[model samples]
Target: MNAEKPPGSKQALVIIGMHRSGTSATTGALRCLGVDLGNRLYKGHEGINDKGYFEHSDLADANDEALSALGSSWDDILLRQENWWKREELIPFAARIRSHIRKDFANSSIWAVKDPRVCRLLPWWLEIFDSERISPRFIFVIRSPHAVFRSLERRDGFSMEKSFLLWSLHYLEAEQWSRNFPRAFVDFDRFIEHPAQELARVEETLGISFPISVENAAPCLNQFLSRDLRHHQERESPESSPVLSLTHALHQSLLGAVDSGQPDSLEMDALWNKMESIQSGFPRALVEHIRSSGSIQGNLQITMNRLMRSWSWYTGKPVRFLERLAGRNV
Candidate 1:
């Protein structure tokens, strides 16, 4: 076996995957393995993700802005051209990311950054890394489509088909975007079941051994990767659409890739090509609006109208009082 990473290793482990796909969990596991995940991670909600998100909020916010600058968002099923991340609007954010790396991980080595958004924003990150002379290794998390759907449905009210589409886009794009880089895939279930085995696989692929062994980190992993932490179990469900069938197949391939150490894009190439061809029509206009706003438009509009009415009543109160006094004097 190879020696563990030294104190001077500049390896940045980039963890990417679709939301509700265990990217957070993988990040947590990596943290237990002695990866520096920074101090500004997102807070964990009670029922949603009690073990903490393990996502760097700063990078996550910048990622949101990068997507917004392109008139896209995390939930939008549409993917922009690779050049979109190169736009002027994204430059400042890229610089911010660079500054963040310099300041936060100044004395650290073998630090990890985990954000599901990175699955789509890898192109931008690659450019940033090139300028910083930093090396990046990718770890993609995979979960069952049905489990992801159930989790997203509970958290975001997303439909099954929409969940399938988002899952496909994130995974396929992450795979395509990071093809040239050092990357590995881990199944969420397997990681939870046997984190030591998964970490060994990661070490083999990424060429960097963790400072701490999984055996040493067993206490932490046992607590963090509890069965309760995984809210949804993998329930095999029928795929109603051809696109969904492709998504399901892609997911299965990812699970296989975990063992084979190859995503086997040869078989997935046609499926991804077809997915991109038909993606424009998957989430229709109204659906796109919902994704961008992060809520249902009709409900939001109704809430706005009520606020306006209340404001109108408050502003008109003095005038109504004056009118009433004038009438009484008359």
Candidate 2:
């Protein structure tokens, strides 16, 4: 088989998926294995992530700002123009973004950068990082559209129409990219349901092994990991958390569809369960706030609240972005 990557900058992993698709948790899981996670890590973000975000702060912010300059935002960037890549002005501008990511992550081996925005800019990455020096192991996180639209509507107050559009665009781009590379599709729901096993599938695809100490990183998994370490792990039942079961059921539904050899339904269900499972971790109060917020505007507001918190963790600016947007330029 013809190889797309060359010998030796080490085979690095790149996580591609929409936002709220368990990218952070997966990054943490991989760190638990043996990967080098650059020079810094973002602290836990509020509203969405209770733990933290690990993507590069500036890179994310730059992408956000660029979208804003086009009079739309990330939520709506995909639908605005299919020809953003063809913009002559953006070529050199994007090249700089590529150079920066490479320089910042130069020291790491078998590194992975997980950000949904990166998927949209694949052509740019392919242009800049096409060299054989960097062997990229692509990992795509697949989640469900129903859950994604629901979550986007819930978290961002997006209109069902808007959420559906975004959900479809995001996953379609992800699916298309998956076809072009040596990639692994991770069921977000399953990864959370059986993190170790799901992660092992990714590890095997990348030809790597996770470290034995990953269990020590999260206390919630103590009982789960202690039970089996091999096949299935036992999990605690929480009285206040029936949502976990809903998430898991969604996973089984999707897995069963795949087992039945229905590729189309399997793919669709996989995306839905993954998104739903990740959101199941949110506090009950947050879920209610989303439900009551009603539609696209409400959901966007809620998601932005959480997103601000995550960006804060990534950049160590408690209210930097907020202040800057407020004209304070902090």
Candidate 3:
């Protein structure tokens, strides 16, 4: 954290979006604008996300633990229950979040945190923010559901149907939770094509300014928001398919509202209803399949680790004996 306060310093910027939906790029762009992402950032995996995730590790871990307490994980489409905020378990999680803020962001005036898991956990975070007297600004990044589905398939081995539902679940939660806060929506495709314009819109809409000038930020933006970074591009509009039409409609509506500077709650509510209707009919078999696969994968990994340990233990003496023999022969 920097000692000096920058112009238009916000208390915190929370970037909310589904996984593989350009949250990392949005966070990286904000970092260029001089938003502190705290000292401990998730470097992100090499092949999956060569560019950094820009999410604080302590906060992210806390969110993971919080999700687990709520009977959810990052991969689960069904996040917390409707009344999750009232759960007694969240009390400790909120305390942990407060400690993390004190430890990681104590010296910063304007810091940002981005994690896809935060989409569903906003209620928990909001409680902490209110208790701690921290004002939060939100940035929601949305990509076409088709693109998100493809990316999830390649990365997580998720089925197209499961991915679509997960994307819908995340965005629905984000929209519902973030309505009270000052928020700006960035279309991932448009942001990639014209990052400066989108970021400028975010600044103006949120009533915050970047610490650095657009000229300085431009170079960093170029380095971060390149076309090659986008792994999945929608071949046809998501609206063209029945499975993705609701997501596409909701995303377009949110984007329109953000651009017009007035988000329509009634329209958003209607969209949510429609989405819920569709999701009600989502196949239970698919959900079970995904969960079963995950369990099998975890079990296989544990079995492999046990086997490797056993092999090492059994072969240790013989290997050492062979090494001594080789040394004597030499």
Candidate 4:
């Protein structure tokens, strides 16, 4: 399915979000509606999602290493790519990935890609695809800050203070890009509560139908989604939230060393100080909603729901069954 389209073709559908954000679910939803997910994919360790995800592992790993070499972690430099917009570094990498997508999905009219790292490389994408006449629609998924921070904390072992700050920064970066692009933001909370409605929204935006069913893939989806949700809301049960003793001195040490030239770092003295600044700069109502929500519990629920939806490939026994059927077909 890799045929080149004639000029003036409708753009491809690209999904953007934080790592644990509902990127996978959104991509899977598109797949359900007839988007082709390439054969090669990346998977997470067990517990996050039982079914493996379909991200391009090679691309993501290489990008992560590149980002680190620039003196920033993926979570740290997320969406902060002036270099990309200036047509300097990282553009070539984006070009390669975009080329691969075009080559791989040549015969397909619709396809979806989910790589959290894409959040930062958007400007490069626009430079390559949009300028070169490859039109593409974007789907952005968001979860509450509380959920985002909590889930991230568990995954990275980052402190809540650091987690919250990073969560805010990540969303703000994504929001800035979405505002200037053809995109839609799917609130993780809203999507899970009404999958059909969210899927329909995506369908309407991309002008395509995604008919895949979550009913059959619920087992893997549900489990993967559940853990993400549970981990994020752990604060609700302080007893379950992993507790590590920290001294005021250590807190100060972290706050003192956080000067990586991030814009929000200068605003507040405490680690959580920059959160408000980042949230203020975000260009969406969801940011406000998340700020007011206060409780991480809601966000946790949103995470689980999105995770389940994203892990469509592993959701049901049909995947194994389909493999057998394919074997017969081949």
The candidate that wins on TM-score is 1
User: Mind giving the per-residue lDDT tens digits that candidate 4 earns over 163-192?
Assistant: 544544544444445443455556676666
Model 3: C-alpha RMSD to truth? 8.2
Of 3 and 4, the candidate ranking higher by TM-score: 3
Lowest lDDT sum, 10 consecutive residues, model 4, at 241-250
For candidate 3, lDDT tens digit of each residue in 1-330?
001122323388989889999899889888888888888776666677888778787677777666656555677754344677779977786798899887877787678889888887777777777766777888989787778888888887997767877887787777787776788888888888899998899888888867886668898888778887788888554234444776667767767865686557788777778766765676989756655655455445445435534657557757766877889531
Q: Candidates' TM-scores? A: 0.83, 0.61, 0.80, 0.60
Candidate 1, position 59, lDDT: 76
- Candidate 2 at residue 309, lDDT? 57
* 1-330 per-residue lDDT for model 2 (tens digits): 122444445556777766666677677667666665565444564555656667765555555444433443456522324555556645555666667657766766566666676665555444445543566667766566445545566677765445444545455454444444556667666676677666666666657644444445445343323212112122333333233434345444434532342225456545545544545566878655543443354345445646765745558675777887789955
**Model 2 alpha-carbon miss at residue 310, Å:** 14
Model 3 segments more than 4 A misplaced: 1-10, 237-243, 279-330
**Backbone clashes under 3 angstroms, per model:** 0, 17, 0, 17
Candidate number with the higher lDDT (1 or 3): 1
Task: Please list the Cα RMSD from the true structure of every candidate, rounded to 1 decimal place.
Answer: 10.0, 10.8, 8.2, 14.3
Ranking by TM-score: 1, 3, 2, 4
Q: What lDDT would candidate 3 get against the real structure? A: 0.75
Q: How many angstroms is residue 189 displaced in model 1 relative to the true structure, after the best TM-score fit?
A: 0.8
Error of 4 at 209 (Å): 3.9
Q: lDDT: which is higher, 2 or 3?
A: 3
* lDDT per residue (tens digit) for residues 212-309 in model 1: 88789888877778666678987877546876788878988888888888778787787687787776565577656655674343234335435534
Candidate 1: the clashing residue pairs are none
